[model samples]
Target: MTTERKAARLPVFDRAAATPEQEAVLDEILSGPRGNLAGPFLAWIASPELAEHAQRLGAFCRYSTGLPLRLSELAILITAVQWRAQAEWQIHYPIAIDAGVSADVAQALLEGRRPVFVDTDEALIYDFAVELYGAKRVSDMTFAKAEERFGHETTVNLVGLLGYYALVAMTLNVFAMRANEDEPLPFNE
Candidate 1:
């Protein structure tokens, strides 16, 4: 008996075949902090209008939001795990660590275990994100603590960051995006 294995594929659009609107959106993304079109952008470009709006919103959530990089990346990591988004996890894991999330925490998360956080803010963000992901809403205590630690604007941004990364994770999953061959799944499943 013979068995067949499917080859990995990524459904990327060719800029050479792009419509004017698609070209414009691609240009905007390439010119932004992203400095390149990759990952979810490749899939999103299929609908230029959606791409434009989503990329802008993503830029705000990733770059302009009041949440620090570590916190935002923490939220993104949680979203990635919730969605089992290999692409998102591959891209953000190192950034999360560089932004000050501990390696132990990241590893524990990847192992599908609760991370031991040494920082109060890290603990708060982890609890808030996990509760939100698991319950679709945080408990009043978690919400109150997040609001107190992060303040109103930052708290709102944290929610937005979670939501934005969730969208990214969904896009990557729907498109069957794959991480590089060398990069293993960040979570144990």
Candidate 2:
């Protein structure tokens, strides 16, 4: 007989089991743009102090940043790809599409191929993010192009968006977070 082993769930703080500080942080997250707590926040709440500040920073990066939703989501998808964080990819892929990223572009990114960008801004975001993640820094030409087209503030926000999502991806990856079973894996590998 073959034996099947169930996947181990990471130790995540539930509202009922939360400390007073953790509950306060959970309440704040529930009331924020996030609406419900899940993913990285589950792991983060274990460290209530860090969770409080991190969630606020995440809310700013995700909601109030200078970059439009499409660009910000694009940067997030790039971060997910870089980290191969399935949970992050699953969460952001639909949001990215809703924000104007094409299905073809998202599919190409999933397959580790160069995406056919439908917009100039999309192309710029992909190039800048891929270069930054792969090279640890973008070349002067790429930086200049991003700054010229998006403005210095938007460019800086894009960087921050990328970094914030990278942190989310790292948390998801470290905790072996899984997406909904109905969702397809973002990458085959």
Candidate 3:
């Protein structure tokens, strides 16, 4: 009996030559996930591909009903950095910037420096991510601050962002998803 183990393939969408359906799904996913998948989101209908989940997550961030968009992105960025998922970090850094995370703050987070724009809300969110990722729960003080600044719905969404990105970071790392060789690291290493 032959027993050779084949290598696992990394999950990714070939953006250059995606099928029409795939392209459509990618577009809808990139657009954010408010659809029922019965329409434009059909491309991912019932699909369990990693890209699908990633798209759903992207949509969640884009369409989140609670947290401010930039804050949510910061939470995801923190998870990406802590998990050391280079691809995730690189891909989302621009999104974070677009969503209003300052370039310097994003760079510092990516580069392991203390955040340069530590306002009350930013620090609260950062601490929330750190405690949640580190302990799987929030301390009472962190929870209190989060509620004070963002209320309950945003707090719940923050937790959702953490869980989503944790899965993404682990998947990308295990698959050894490297950043495009041409793309520079999002921050100085």
Per-candidate local distance difference test: 0.82, 0.83, 0.66
Top candidate, metric TM-score = 2
Candidate 1's C-alpha runs over 4 A off are: 1-12, 187-189
Question: TM-score order of candidates, best first?
Answer: 2, 1, 3
lDDT value, candidate 2, whole model: 0.83
TM-score (C-alpha) between model 1 and the true structure: 0.91
lDDT of 2 by residue, 21-97 (tens): 98888889989888976568777876899999999989999987788898888888888988999888988898999
Q: Using Cα atoms with residue i matched to residue i, what is each candidate's TM-score against the true structure? A: 0.91, 0.91, 0.71
Better TM-score candidate (1, 2): 2
Give the candidate number with the greatest lDDT.
2
Residue 14 displacement (Å), model 1: 1.6
lDDT of 3 by residue, 1-189 (tens): 121111144333345656665666666654654432211122232243655666766567546747777887788789888887776787678778899899888878877776966567777888888888789889998899888888888777777778877876776566555445467655333
lDDT of 1 by residue, 1-189 (tens): 111111234444666778999989988998999886656877787799999999999999999888888988888887888889888988888889999888898878877888887888888988998898898889999999989887989898888888989999988887767555466666554
Q: Where's the lowest-lDDT run of ten residues in candidate 2?
A: 1-10
lDDT of 1: 0.82
lDDT comparison, 2 vs 3, better candidate: 2
Question: What is the lDDT for 189 in model 1?
Answer: 48
